[model samples]
Target: MPAPVRTAAQWAQFGRDHVSHGLGRMQDLVVVKGEGLDIYTSDGQKLLDFTAGIGVTNLGHCHPAVTAAVQNQVGSLVHMQCSIMFHAPYLQLIERLLPVMPHPSLDQFFFWNSGSEAIEAALKLARKATGRPNVVVFQGAYHGRTYGSGALTRSKPIYTQSTGPLMPGVYTTAYPYWHSLGVPPSTSEEEIVRLAKHQLDMLFRQQVATKDVAAIFIEPVQGEGGYVPCPAPFMNHLRELCDKHGVLLVIDEVQTGFFRTGSYFSVNHIKGFRPDIMIYAKGIANGFPLSGIVSNKEIMATLDVGSLGGTYAGNAVACAAGVAVQDVFASEDIGGNVNARAEQLYNALYALRDSPKTAPLVAQVRGQGLMAAIEFRMPNDPLTHEGLDKGTHIPSNIGKRVQEFCLSKGLVVLTTSCFDTIRFIPALVVSEEQMDKAMKIFTEAVQNVANEG
Candidate 1:
């Protein structure tokens, strides 16, 4: 018998009753289907999807190639545990990834189910390889919510609050984000970089020594931590520091990989950049639960055979989807599309930032490629005029109001970090018309919210 269809309200009630309240949601709409840059709600509304499942469906929802691949793999072989046996899809995915890796040194791969799992695996590998007890992460970094990764995360207190006895030997340092440094948006990158470097140096001296640090984890473009891009000079400085101290550099590309940043990886935008370990997920399989870490052979060889296997690490269906995603990237100029659409989106955002009606509320417009954000300044708060203290930026509801307004107008966007910031992560394949429509809705939402104050 066919399952009975439930009304949108019934479905939402069911979720509320059974689902964990801890899980945060952007909207209450019960989405039934998605295609291209739109999601169809059960209530018969089609909304423009700017979040792209929080940057998961880079090829767009139900991308034909990825869908077909998943269907085929389900019929052929769905779950061949990685430790028990090697499947054709898993091997095929590795082959597909080899040619597109951001750096030639990142030749080895280990598959996992989520971004957090990949992060955990990278941490283990870094520690085991270096035999060091300590790890370092940047302020405003969001690695993941899992126990180990949560300790590495410094985006907000909410992530690590009350979760004490957390992973030990993890230290936090400063990232070159002007907003976090309590500086004007017009602050020079050189000065920001200098401040960040000084903070990291101080951390090494005050907290953990360089020799004790196993690896320094970083997001090329911070995701939940306000979509801040690490400057190239600062990145190079990290490489130099790592080289000088023998600390491994781990780049978390969970949200910045798969050409979402107009390049294979956000780090690729930095000239001649290479990480000791590179983590990837989110867009890897076009919404399928797949993530992995890549490193050179020597680094990977340090681990024991039994140390890094997961029962569902390399699920055949997800690997098949990954292979198909690679094929699509290879055949389509998705990177070019991302670049063009990013330019359009940024231009619109800049216009909003410059508009007199909204300029007071718009603190800064930042990010790269398709991964972008607009941070708002709370006018009534004294912090708006003064420099913000570390981790103490006054919270504003402007982003939430803008988000609500956009949702009312049939648009889907996400608020990020702990401040009043809204991020735009459209699909890599998002069309020009779709982008324009999204921007129109977003512009009105911003204007309406800004005018309210």
Candidate 2:
């Protein structure tokens, strides 16, 4: 098919008419250009990007290093089947990535194209390594949408509605969300962690047998379920449980990896937790499609040759970009910046959460590093549903309203966690000035929503 030459409006209409609506469509703006965390629409409006293309561009859009790397590699070698031959960029990336692994034993890697594919690959590795038939996942986790991934995702019903019978032997367990567990806002972190840890034991006895499980998948900070950070004590307990059961502790850092969580990985916040397998994507290449998993040699050895690679698994261009990303991180204090900005963001969000007008609507303000969220709830509403019955918070699209309002103010944001929570996942390269500007707009959006309500 040839490119269509049409006006911006015409192109937009054509997309609405011809494009498959299955993909998530949050806004209608047609972006034409991007630079350093700002995107330009066809109308020549500049929007400060807070979503960072849904956490893909961690170094900001079109960082000079990444652009140069891609341009340089495209002219040399863009595609090389990993199964057929090896490449410098791929090996170089592995070399750079090895030093950053949380544990020294996590030395093995298998590249893939997307987070979903990496997750699918990890699932296969777990099952093969343990020779177990069952996999365990937490409730309200969003691993991916592929059929195999869908079986593990329990964030929302729409993801798996009419998509089952999902893959067999996949079990769901409750995660620690004190606000959603009917606990008062004053509940201490220790108590929440205790209750959450206790649920795992109940799940094992009442639900799936721990002996049959191959892996227990979880996110240090829940992404789509809301940017809820898992408490350290709870994660510590999970580590103990996995150790006792010999289940692989697979941490899905697809959204939280690459310094998004202040640390190199969110799991790093916990003192002694070590994952058996770590899967990463999103910011791995600062926008390029690259994802992979790291495991020790022994577990990785379980897969026979020709068992785990794809034709385009380690594409040269993506690996080159990945290599450049690591270089950028080495030179830039991105992890430091994320921590500093996260503190500022949390202060501002807490102000909003505590203010008179917004307090009643905000159920909680939670985050770690740059990954943050403001969860909204309408306590006065008389409506009762499954979420209410199950003691889970049901969003009322307040986050979506805030998102649209932010867009109107030349800022871009995303809604997550049941459409009730506003997630802030800006690029790690975002400056303090940019953060203040975005927060100003966000504050007004919350105020406007409160007034309208």
Candidate 3:
């Protein structure tokens, strides 16, 4: 067969015609392969990866150990229907992860292929256990885009624009980003808890009836909703509220699990916050497509043998990668390294805020662990206060400019739902040297694009 000769733009246009309009595609870089936290485009540009494939690659791209593990499993068995039977890798992974998890009561896990599927299972289990219908989510939440999880998502009209008439009995309340959501002032910690309680209380008035509500879904450190961490008191109180109302607390750790936040799960960050059910993925398999919903012995026992499984639910190859991921994380002090890198990155980006390059458009810097964001805002002339708090399309456009500049100059970053912010989900294994290289490039990109954006 002869090679198909066509320009990249032509190929992209072809995709545009064949694919649904809902799919977002851009002709930015033609990537070939990846290594660690760097990607090589078709044209031979090696770029530092801060997005980590949008937080999917916490161990880094094509990590040697993970790749080797996958290769070995592939030679043995890549696909096996756990619904029909079980495989070594699948059982092996659960045995390994059980001890590391926060809850001692957790006894069973149902493996799924993606974060959305994991969340879907969690929701189902919550309803099955409680025999309830209503589920509570928060404003600015971004769970996966499937029907149930998507229904739980409470951000912008765009995500839910075309897909409508979603699942009912899904309630929502604000999660505090005190400065952004027009909250008058940075509330005291007590006030934050008060506000959350008040909002949930108000929701019981109409959005969702307390008795019928099955679960309250939460992210310990929010992933897509601008990396906001729910304060400890707020989380603890929510636990109390769930206990009072017979609501299952479902922690969505799709983005916060697997040492991304210096713990196996971010829910551990709170003093006593533990979920009746939890979804885990992203970093668990170290870039493999393995996600799961875990629950207490009682809740998990409700499922019939055949109720929760799929053809590729616990893929041996993906599980093999997961097993190796945990091993490397444990033996190599990857968690410690993640903490050190977070500190290093926090210091670097914080210091760079005052740098001559980033002063104009930089509004706020916030996030946890390897998940961080640099929010770009329109230069509010504090002199006039024209739009001191009013959000404009300017920040969105500036973000695009910065993203392009980063790509052009050998760096990769991700934009967020806030539109004005670019998130950095660097790999847990990112070295100090790699960190310096990426930050230097970022500083340069900011300097180059600042005047224009």
Number of the predicted model whose TM-score against the real structure is largest:
1
Question: Which pairs of residues collide in model 2?
Answer: none
Per-residue accuracy of model 3 over 143-259 as CA lDDT, tens digit each? 878888899887666777687888888878878665434453225657766777787788888666789999999888777777777888788878888999898999998998888
Q: What is the lDDT of residue 340 in candidate 1?
A: 94
lDDT for each candidate structure: 0.90, 0.86, 0.78
Which candidate gets the maximum lDDT versus the true structure? 1
Task: Point out the higher-scoring one by lDDT: 1 or 2.
Answer: 1
TM-score for candidate 2, please give it: 0.95
Kindly list the per-residue Cα lDDT of model 2 for residues 1-453, writing each as its tens digit.
Answer: 998677778777877988887766886668999999999888678889999888899999999999999999999998989999999999999999998888788898999999999999999999999999898888789999998888889889888898688889998777888644556645788887877777877878998888899999999999999888888888888888889989999999999999999988888888656899999999999889999999999999999899989878979999999999999888889999998898889988999877977665676788889999987775444322212344544345677888889999998888886547789999998888999998899999988888877
Root-mean-square deviation (CA) per prediction: 2.8, 3.3, 3.0
Residue pairs whose backbone atoms clash in candidate 3: none
Runs of candidate 1 with Cα error greater than 4 angstroms are 1-5, 380-383, 386-396
Which digits, one per residue and each the tens of the lDDT, describe model 1 over residues 27-129? 6778989998889999899888899999999999999999999999999888999998889999999999998777898899999999999999999999999
C-alpha lDDT (0 to 100) for residue 17 of candidate 1: 86
